[model samples]
Target: MKIMEYMKERFQNLEFIPSIYNQWGIGIHFCLGENIYQLKEKEELNLKRFQVVYEQITIIFNELFEQNDDIFLVTNMYKHKKEKCIRKLKVYQPFLKCKNQKCKNHLNQILVKTYPYPFEINKAEEYEMQQFSLLCKPRDLRVTELLKAASNEDFPLKPKFGGYSTDYPDVFFVNITKDNIFFIYDDRGCEVIALDFKRIRHLYEKYHDWVEEYKCM
Candidate 1:
């Protein structure tokens, strides 16, 4: 088969793998390319027999893992927004106009909520030390459309940062790894949800190790 055909089949097969969260179905991320490359470089050729198939398949695998990981900030944004709706708070949006004057479009910061962090933070103040802006995830319909668009590709939805848009309200994901805390804010800069990173490296590794077992299946 052609390279394109091979990649299509590979990703389709990936859909069968269940999410680590709860046997929920989900695809891997697309940002793990560098990780895979590093893993390959670290391999000891003398101890292991490297094959063309393994190399080719892992290139895609690492990308999927990393692509799914964004700083914990996305989850924070969702929480903050939800709180405002509940209390009837006015959502604040920063005035970041679209650079295109004739385009009849403008942009602002938005935060989206996500799951707890994979690690912890010891220094809580680090999160407050700096402000950050994040890319907003596409809405449901937009996400669906994107999936459909990617379905035809060799590496469909090779997940990377999507471009800026007006819909996303700015937010922050705070105290990752440095100290085990997650702070989520809404479009209006209000604290919405705060949580601790439940997954320690040991725990996450235990779960991730299952992927090795998954490969056998």
Candidate 2:
């Protein structure tokens, strides 16, 4: 089922959204640094703890996302927008498109899906969107630039990557810039959905408290 809502019914016509949870599927939720970010009421303390763990999670995500792997970006809207809260995306038109036919052909070359973020819930639907997926090599997406630029109040600006086994062949949905969590599920389905997670396991083995696991929603 869909974790988020579509801004328009027409978007339903595209390929399936990656966030669509798989039926009868097992998964894992890597908690944000032992949930320490929630324990701290003092903003400074939380930020300090968050920085350390965030870097660690970013490392884990990077390890999972190989440098040469084909990646899918849920695009169509602006790269960044005003987010009052997590998942609640309020946006303007992002002027990111292939400037030339070569680039356009390189992008969205195959596999496209349209999905919504949390903003479509309640009254935020006023910001009608036309979000769809795009596919390209990792370098084509400009991973470092996208990550560096989106460290602030934008949905995609602070994105994260997630691997979901949504019915067979498996899928990797990299929410380029959103939350602080680096989520992946290998509880079942294909053991080789993507990377082998050698480093993530090393982190868990040596630093169990640094990571948290939960059944995906």
Candidate 3:
């Protein structure tokens, strides 16, 4: 099945819907015909369903990276594992086509099911490990820059702190925030990428700030 179809099927099975709303009773938001964000205000079966949806999306993301080389993935390893570590993940397809039809050479490469993380994160570490595949995930570049700039000294925020994980595989998602954001980690506990929430929110805010900035200009 196409990856999108797989995700939609998974999403449909979860039966997730918006249960929470703002004070003004707004419960859902969309961008580019996608349900980019939602809030949950009530405790219902759908809450569990939402969690399932999130996990499925994480799995699908990993599959996409492993299947297509055209896509780029990066993640913040240190943020998730702590220490002065970071990781840049790349996905590769298993087979390459031969240019010569007469040669009949079908070269095959090892399909990397999982990218080994330096750390030793396992099911014993957290319940999340049980439900999702933690190895061989995808990441993006923002996390790479964060790793380059961060200090190597171990601090209290080391393990039980803000690490990295993005919601999607190909897209950028970093977990270096004080707020609660979504994340997916490698088997050894590495963030795939720092997410682009700041950009999203900045764009939202820009709509309001444009008038003031325009006046100053």
Residue-by-residue lDDT tens digits, candidate 1, 131-168:
12333221111332222222212222222122222122
**Full ranking by TM-score:** 2, 1, 3
* Candidate of highest lDDT: 2
Candidate 2 yields a Cα-based lDDT of: 0.35
Query: TM-score of every model?
Result: 0.21, 0.44, 0.19
Model 1: runs farther than 4 Å from truth? 1-99, 102-106, 109-119, 125-217
Q: What is the alpha-carbon lDDT for the whole of candidate 3? A: 0.24
Candidate 3 stretches greater than 4 Å from native = 1-48, 51-66, 77-82, 86-217
Lowest-scoring 10 consecutive residues by lDDT in candidate 1? 183-192
Candidate 2 local lDDT, 1-217, one digit each (tens): 1212321221232233233322212223334434444235553344554354446545555755665554454433312234322121211112223457756464434333333433435544433334444544455554543432232211222333222112111223442222111222322111111122432355445544544442322
Count of backbone clashes, every candidate in sequence: 29, 8, 16
- Winner of 1 and 2 under TM-score: 2
